[model samples]
Target: MTVALWCILIAFLLPYLCTYVAKISGGFRLKDNHDPRDFLDSLNGLGRRAYAAQLNGFEVTPAFAAAVIVAHLAGNAELVTIDVMAVLFITSRLLYIICYLVDWAILRSLVWLVGMGLIVGLFVVSA
Candidate 1:
């Protein structure tokens, strides 16, 4: 599979990673599994931020996946370019999560913009 395709997989999985962070840090337990949403909702500080990040990850992943797939379907942009953008998006998301966890609001917003730009750039390059 192409690197971009691999990135789609990574994007899909990233939110779960964030949730795991929330779980581990938030003291989630088996009983919490019965009401996972409530458990996550009850988190504070880093755990809360991590949960927020996970939600954002889920929100953006589909667009990123669609952009990658559409770019591939268009077949106008070079595969390398698409791959690079995908990698950058993933990197930006990782940074975003870190920023969110540490309460770096401004930096996190900047990183989010960068990720969105990468998504748009994929489509632009394909055109």
Candidate 2:
């Protein structure tokens, strides 16, 4: 797959990592509830932060995927542009996760902005 497509794949998995952390850290039991949201409400501290990150990860997916698809369809995106921006987005997201887990709100926000910018950059390149 292209690097951009690989980025999409990685993006798809990002939320799951947070979910895994939340589940393991929070020690959520499968029988606790049938509803996922209800189960998620039990998270606290780092687990809660992870849940927030996971939510952000899911929230960002549609826009990121659309940007990538649009860029690919526009036929304006260079491989380097797609690859570099994808890497930047992924790196920023990874850092965001770490910052969130550590309770570094300011840094996490900045990192989130960087990732957003990279997402926009992907759209720009495709345009």
Candidate 3:
């Protein structure tokens, strides 16, 4: 239950926090930059990726939590397994965001695939 709550919080907060981090580090300020367009573009890109990852997390949590909760209600909750998968999913997404930010082509793609597989695995195993 706690994990689920944390997952929800992280899922929601990661994007906002990541965007803020990127914006501040990318020269964001109260005043507009000399080239406002470029600054906006940079911020937009960072925000987009953060949003994409957040969407992925959102997609996973409901299904994952529902499966785990339903199973528990039915006397078959594999709490540890669900928790492990949840942790893995979150960690992999963090790795993914880093890789995406750095433009690490190969490693990013590999981790992306693994992250997808992990989500699929959650569904598969839950059933």
Candidate 4:
């Protein structure tokens, strides 16, 4: 599998990390009947961000994975193009999580844009 595929695997698990963080935060009880939205409110600091990041991670995963798979199989782009975009996408995602946890709003948005661009680049350069 390509590094991009490996990154997709890693991305698959990123949300669980955020969930673990949410549990460690004030919203530790996974069994509660509370709405998921309220769980975020219960968290005061990094915890809230963790929950938000988890949701965001989920939001991005499908598109990323689809793009990676389709691009890998159908893309006529140079291997270097594929590889570079893949690595950068992963790097941006990891950085995005950190930026979320640290509450770096502007930076996180920029990083997200970078990630999104990489995804689009992957698709565009693919056949």
Maximum-TM-score candidate = 1
Model 2 local distance difference test score = 0.87
lDDT measured at residue 23 in model 2 versus the true structure, 0 to 100: 81
Model 1 bad stretches (over 4 Å): none
Stretches off by above 4 angstroms in model 2 are 30-37
Query: Per-residue lDDT for 1-127 in model 1, tens only?
Result: 9999999999999999999999998898878677777776678998999999999999999999999999999999999999999999999999999999999999999999999999999989989
- What C-alpha RMSD separates each model from the true structure? 1.0, 1.5, 4.6, 2.5
Better of 1 and 4 by TM-score: 1
lDDT of 2 at 120: 84
Between the candidate structures 2 and 4, which one is better when assessed by lDDT?
2
| Model 3 residue pairs with clashes | none
| lDDT string, candidate 3, 30-109, tens digits | 67656543664554455555545555555555654554455445544366766676677677778877876665758877
**TM per candidate:** 0.96, 0.91, 0.66, 0.86
- The best-first sequence of candidates by TM-score reads 1, 2, 4, 3
- Ten residues in sequence with the least summed lDDT for candidate 2: 32-41
Task: List, residue by residue over 37-86, the lDDT tens digit for candidate 4.
Answer: 56656687888888889999999988999888878888688767787788
Model 3 is weakest, by summed lDDT over 10 consecutive residues, at 68-77
Tens-digit lDDT track of model 2 for 1-127: 7888888899999999999898888887778557656666777898999999999999998888888878778888687788778878888989999999999999999999999998888887876
* Candidate 2 accuracy as TM-score: 0.91
- Least lDDT summed over 10 consecutive residues: which range in candidate 4? 33-42
